[model samples]
Target chain A: MKNINLLAMLSLLAILWSCGDDDDAKPAEFGTFQVYFDNKVGADDITRRDNGSTEYDFETSTGEKFNLSLLGYYVSKITLEGPNGEYFQDEMKASASEAKGYYHVLEGESASQNIKLEQVPAGTYNKITFAIGVEEDGVLEGAAGGVLDPADGAWFWNWNAGYIGFALEGTAENSGQEYVDWGGGRETLENTFAIHIGGWKDVADNENFINNIKTITLDFGTTVKVGPDLSPLAHLVTDAMKVLDGAAIDFSNTFSVHAPKAGKPFAEQLPQVFSVHHVHQSTSGHD
Target chain B: MISKTKKYLVYGWVLFLFWSCSDDDAASPKDIYAFEKPAHFPDATYTFENNPITKEGFELGKKLFFDPILSRDKSVSCNNCHQQSRAFADSPLHPTSIGVDNRVGIRNAPPLANLAFMQEFFWDGGVTHLDFVPINAIESDVEMDETLVNVVKKLNEHDEYPLLFEKAFGVKEITSPFMLHAISQFTAMMVSAGSRYDKYVLEGTALSNEEMAGMKLFEKKCATCHSGELFSDFSYRNNGLNDSFGDLGRGRITEDEADHGKFRVPSLRNAELTAPYMHNARFLTLEEVLDHYDGGMVDSPTLDPLFKDGDQVVGISLTTEEKTSIIAFIKTLTDRDFIAEPKFRNND
Candidate 1:
């Protein structure tokens, strides 16, 4: 009877200790975080697509005027970072059979106006980072479904065997290639400058070309405080002018970069296009 | 019925045990199907990091290489263009590489030897990676002309291939990267460093006075471009085959006018067997190739600087004696052991 009373007293103390620990260390809550990529030609947001009848003028950092027809590129492997090293990663990945992380922020897809990142660990996230294109492993995996799916068209160079990670179709009279007219009243200038920068495979003994993985990281600078009461919305502005800003190859004359040698200049400057313009934060984590 | 089922299970377990033991039965795992990298040869550029070359993977790769199932119509195989007899080059039957639907290839199919040291592939050097070379051929309109997805689907559907793939890679469903890697393992293992010339260099083997003279002649005239231990520096240069471009060659890939008419420097190893020579199979024989270097070179702006001595022609100077001796020396590069390697032959 003396031993039994002692055991009972110990068990009661254990339950009290567990309850005290739960009240002291309450688990943090999490919610969905939305990231929006807003495209712009200078200060003006691209709102109009004037079929072939009208061409929108885009002025580069070099102050050279060119007309753009289509402007969209893939952004993949999105990662979110907290100041205190709190980490949350997405499990889904894009492949030749299925598209998971592949997001093509198209011109008029307000339907997917923002990429919804679900169940982000509830905390103050200072930055967002993502790869500009898919790495070589994804490129060599052949065809995939969704945004990476070639059935969507104009992304893959079938004969050459590579995915065009960053594609910008436009027209310049001085651009030293033939004009591409995609009917719908869509007509580029006499010369079309198609910048398709992508290559993650080596060609033997060619020192003057890019034969390795090309992935540029875009880190959002603005601080975002996310919690259960607040799922922060980060606005990222990507400008096409930044791609050719102080670029090695003058896009004015030698514009079209289909191969690695020509595409290296633009691939180097891919990060300049992205920046976090604003962030919405809420106060709920600290209690 | 239970006794009969028990007997079958015992038999099945025995077979599985036997099958598993065979792979491990070899002397050392690495030595089972060892890759040859000669002392004088440069380090292999194609690193098998994720895809280690194994006996089963190499065998599966060889099977896939020789198998016609990878082709669209089941008529064309990698072996069709890349024949083992001609040193993994085009057979004499194919003047130029012929593909499915009897389609004509643009350039002459080059030989496959010492590819581990090679950085780029193709006459135009369009393909940077050796593993990617098969994809180009498989997808080309005139070649196999099948989608990579379709090829994967077909391979996965096959009864034997999935098991072979499982044996090579643990995955039940095969992927394109594994396919490319397995094939690369087979291609990379094809080392031609055991030639008589190689033995002569390393072991100081006896050579005839004619071959010795030819070696001297080759060093004096041809060694600059085909300099390395592999006999080719693996560079793309315009050897000035023509004043006007029939095919833009490297220019087609690079899109630079300066690169026009340039072709990859073909390795002279086993040159006696691989003919006709040049990108377009322009030369019917090595004698013709020597003759072209001797006199037939046409002046073009994109011509290699080695060919031009300030607007004056600097073609290879060779006499009848020199040519014969050079041919003799070149013949010594034909590695008999590599061609006769029993493991590379069709198992079936």
Candidate 2:
């Protein structure tokens, strides 16, 4: 009788262990946050439209007067920091058609784009982190579905490879009435412009990460505005322009990055050109 | 006896594994061409970033190259004159290519091989790069007679092109860059470095006595300008073919009278295959070409200084036997592998 009971217990334990080995668990949930890019050069300035086009005039600290035309980029690998030091992450890959927005920005004016997250484990989040451009790995290794899909135009469809991160084109009156265009395509990752502002490597690593992270607090039922000012991301754009302006990116050397054999290095000398501004955030109460 | 909970767990694990594996095994968009450098050749100057190679893009380009849709009246394609057997040159019988409405071009179609090494394109060298050469061919009144905008529009209207573009470029929309890149990829892959002469150089094989004698004669007389791994130095030379034609060769592009009657040195590779040679296809056979070199040289102010001497005059003292030997050597340049390769063949 004792042996029979022991055998039955062992069998029951085995059955329980097998039953617990379930792999299909629901993915965790993450909270959503909004990024707002404010293009207001002055406190009370509204863009006036002439015909079908609207223009905004602004000057850089360097006195480079520009009429802003288009300003858009790709944002992926979204993550949020919670109050208890917990973090929730969501990877929303951009489709190819969606990726097309990275090629050109909307004309004149500030805009807010929402990043939706699902199954995010509900928590108090303090920070939002995401990449400003398409990551190298995602481009080199390839991504499926989501925002990085070719159908979304997030990828560099015209070039038959890679993606474009940030495209800013406008007319610059200060620079001899020349056109100011700064954009990086995903075809060659090593040649993509890096926005490193301030400080030498021996002194301080002030290199702005292509992956921009902003810390903000969010309650379970609240809305948070991520970016209303272009200052924080301005360094990236300016640095890219500086690289392009300096004639540092050799078209022949870094033309393709399809494989590792095409060993082209990422642009390192970028801090000499761009400057970064302060990041601000505002929160709204939700019911 | 497994409980219901145990069964559910097993099912869940299976589902999880299935999904994870599926995610991992997701297919990457296929590339157009698997660009492999030949062991005998040097590194290719062309890079992939500007126009990455993909299978679909190459196939699409090949389809376009062989299709008459590029013509104004849908009567000609790039292949109408540049047939494969003739080493991608114009048919010897047709001195000039016939275009839409039976329009005739001024120059004969040159063999399309080893173009990546060329610094300039066309006999006049008007176009500088291979990427831009197709534009002239597609848009010229004597060639395809189609516009880039119309070609893109037609491709967009096609049922198969959108998907083909998506497969090659990861986009459903057809683009000018994608179209050009695809064609360039196909053209770049049309390399011809496998002739019997190449075998003698690479494999240390012996050439026939006739071919050997011909090689000596070529080195003595012709190798000065036609010297390089690609046969032609890609320089414009006044080979004394004509004192003047209505079209004044390189002079038209430079708008300089000094460059009159100058044309790019044609490569001798596959010379036997592409007959009725020269920019105008005036010579019908190797004998005629030799005859031109022997005694039919035209006198002009811009004649190449190399041929100014009596030895280089219209009629060189070459017996019929020497001409035969030189012809035999030229035939060694015919690359059977290049024409027979499936890569250059029509994919569709």
Candidate 3:
């Protein structure tokens, strides 16, 4: 009877210790986080025009007028970081059927602009990092579904065998493109320009190939609390003028950039194009 | 002197053992469909995990390969340029590809074999994966002249393709990746490793005296570029084919002046059957190709250094006897079984 009493006392002490450990460190809570991309040209919002429309909405520093028919970029590898070593990385995987952790943010598509990340560990995040183009891992995974599928409107390069990371297609006032009726259902516009920034080869000994994928990190300037009750939204502004004006583009000669070497100058200015506009900590969900 | 019942029991036991051994060795269903890597080959580079080879998937890919519905007006198919009779290369009648609407292709249609072991495709090595190679042919204006989206729509509308796709991939809706993956499953299994040269290397089969002499000459004169068991090292080098770049070759892909006039070194497996060689089909026979290496090379800034000796432009010095022997050895690389395999033929 005395030995049984001693065993019962030890079991009671074990239960008390477990309860004390739970009280000291409660379970981590998770909430939603959203990132909004706002595309702009200089100080005005992007106004997408027709493919061959000549009415220019933007002018370069060299006084070359151009109007965009399509403006978009591939965003991937999103991450949230905090000052206190709190971090969250979005999951990335590609298979024959689906491609996860990739977003094709296009102009005039409001639904595509908002990127929602869920199950983030509750913390105070102050910085956001993302990639502007599909990296080598994304392209090396062979044919994929969702946003990376070419049949489903992925900006893919068939000859070079890679995805166009960033695309700017429009009409320029002094473009060198000429109209060609190829006797089929295909024809080139008279003054249209197409700038496709692609190429993902990074050979160790070869310097001829160009890899134009760029990653950008921005500071929110203020921290926002994230928890089960609080959902945070980060507003980011992407300025296209940094690509054209910063590169000192002359549309007469610099209009067509379909190759990697031709697109290097525009891709070099991508790091400075994105910046954080504001941060909102709200009880309601993202709008 | 043995009893009749005892004799029957012994015969039945012997027959049962014989049947079981043969089934395990040859008649097993799994063994026929499996992608068996040849013992002499290097590891395959295909992403088989993304799309494992199933019997149904292979069948679907073969049907698609033979179907001309992939073209714009159903005028051509992959089989038009790639014929199984010529080891999946074009016949000698058409040096380059003769595509839809009688459009003449700029480059020669290369042979397809040992594709799972390859890292890149095309003469310029632009495509890096086997799955993405078909998109170029299907969308090239001189080739299929059909859009990828339209091809998918046509397949969906076909009465038989939808059910075949469902059986292969277990999907309600047909997609490009699945289609590409199915094609890869068929192409990757086209492993060419049963040649006479393969037997000579693997099973110690003796070559003729002439073939042996040619192989020795080949090792000395050509092994710098065509080094490994696969014959070619898969490098892009301008073999002094032209001085002025009409096609621009690899330079168009890299946009680098140094890479001008460069094309991929093709594998010599089954080279005897795949005639009219080179990226532009410059040579009509193996003898002509060897002659080009000896003296016909023109001078160019980007010519392969193998053809140069301190700017003297000294091509490979091969005598007539050596060239004859090398040709004999090269013919041994042709695998008769691969081209004549009934399973690789179109069923429908």
* Best first by DockQ, ranked: 3, 1, 2
- Top candidate, metric lDDT: 3
Best by DockQ: 3
The runs of at least 3 residues in candidate 3 whose Cα sits more than 4 Å from the true structure, single-residue gaps closed, are A1-28, A283-287, B1-30
Taking the candidates in order, what DockQ does each have? 0.09, 0.03, 0.26
Candidate 2, residues B154-230: lDDT per residue as tens digits? 88898888888888888767755567667877887788888999899889789999999998987776778878667
**Of the candidates numbered 2 and 3, which has the greater lDDT value?**
3
Candidate 1 residue lDDT tens string, B1-348: 875665555555545544544555546656847775799899987666545688889999899899878778888889888888888999866778888889988888899988878867788776655666777877776778666667878898998989998888776777776777778888889888778899998999988999999899999889898887888887778886889997998777766677889988989888888998999888898888888888789899999988888997777778878899898988989888878877777776
Native A-B contacts reproduced, model 2: 0.00
> On a 0 to 100 scale, what is the lDDT of residue B256 in model 2?
52
Model 2 TM-score (2 dp): 0.52
Chain A TM-score across all models, in listed order: 0.75, 0.46, 0.88
| Candidate 3's DockQ | 0.26
TM-scores for candidates 1 onward, in order? 0.71, 0.52, 0.90
Tens-digit lDDT string for candidate 1 (A1-287): 44445545554555455444445433468777888878776676765343232354766666565666667777777778887886666555544335677677765666444787777877778777777666665554433456765434436554455667776776654566656765445555555677878765554554554642344444556567667767777777877777766474455567667776777777777767777777676422210
